[model samples]
Target: MSRTASDQSLDGLADGSSVVVVSPERIDPDARVRDFDQLSASAQRLFVSEEETNPATAADLDPGDVVRFTDYYRVR
Candidate 1:
């Protein structure tokens, strides 16, 4: 959507309240802005929003899969 310079004049904006994210570029009447992409809010499921647990946390490994090194030099 496009708003003309006059359409974007401060008269259209209500007093004491404004959008939290007004682009400073929009403050100039001569400047025109159009959003090609915008972020919208949607409630995401807990499966996606919740912290993905670390698979290794509190995990017990099979003895065969465990590897331990006695020397730090081995890491290089």
Candidate 2:
């Protein structure tokens, strides 16, 4: 699967570097979402990726250094 910019950046982060995970609210009301099962699967993938990346504490995140997940349906 093709990786998003955030995903690629996550891959390049140092094991102990500080980072932040932001799950933004879905803003497009008209966009179609998959079923509960599919959404759950997507969430699982996201969680696994995060665990693998294993970023350090978010106590001192920079202004723009964020891993934002915006579109739920397009996560995978």
Candidate 3:
């Protein structure tokens, strides 16, 4: 997965940075959207890691975290 400008912008963020996480599958009117810090530990760990080539899950996401989706782009 190629990094977009939005992805690049997330580089070097401090650990625990506030992030609004959005999932393509949950983009319905009734779906809830929440920030990274607001998520439960299990939910936060479920997001796909930014590093597509690695096995890292969102569990390892910190300092420079991002969520990757197969069919969506980061919304600024």
Candidate 4:
């Protein structure tokens, strides 16, 4: 069964709490996010290339991919 934000009925379940964990993709500072019809000044900003994660990120991605949120303002 799908989980929700609040479903405390898992008390009787043998497994861990029925609480669902939501992990949203965080926009990296270096990554460029489309705001509207155009790209912002973040053109210099590099972002995760859809293969990386905040934690437990596998090297399945590229190096130029945004590895950290602070990679943008870190400066060259």
Residue 18 deviation, candidate 1, in Å? Answer: 0.8
Which ranges in model 4 have alpha carbons more than 4 Å from their true place? 1-25, 39-76
Across residues 1-76, which tens digit of lDDT does each residue of candidate 3 receive?
A: 2323333344563432234333465455553334555545653444433532221233434423334444433332
Clashing pairs in 3: none
lDDT of 4 at 55: 17
How does candidate 4 score on lDDT? 0.26
Question: For every model shown, what is its TM-score relative to the native structure?
Answer: 0.15, 0.22, 0.25, 0.17
Indicate whether candidate 1 or candidate 3 has the larger lDDT.
Answer: 3
Alpha-carbon lDDT, every model: 0.22, 0.34, 0.39, 0.26
- Best of the candidates, TM-score: 3
Q: Report, for all candidates in order, the number of backbone clashes.
A: 0, 0, 0, 4
Which residue pairs does candidate 4 place in steric collision? 30-45, 30-46, 31-46, 47-66
Model 1 stretches astray by more than 4 angstroms: 1-14, 19-37, 40-76
Residue-wise lDDT of candidate 4 within 1-76, one digit each (tens)? 1222222332353443222222224334564322221323333122222322221122222322322232221111
Which should have the higher TM-score, number 1 or number 2? Answer: 2
Highest lDDT, which number? 3
Q: What is the lDDT for 54 in model 1?
A: 18
Sliding window of 10 residues with minimal summed lDDT for model 1: 67-76
Prediction 2 TM-score vs. true: 0.22
Model 2 misplacement above 4 A? 7-24, 36-71
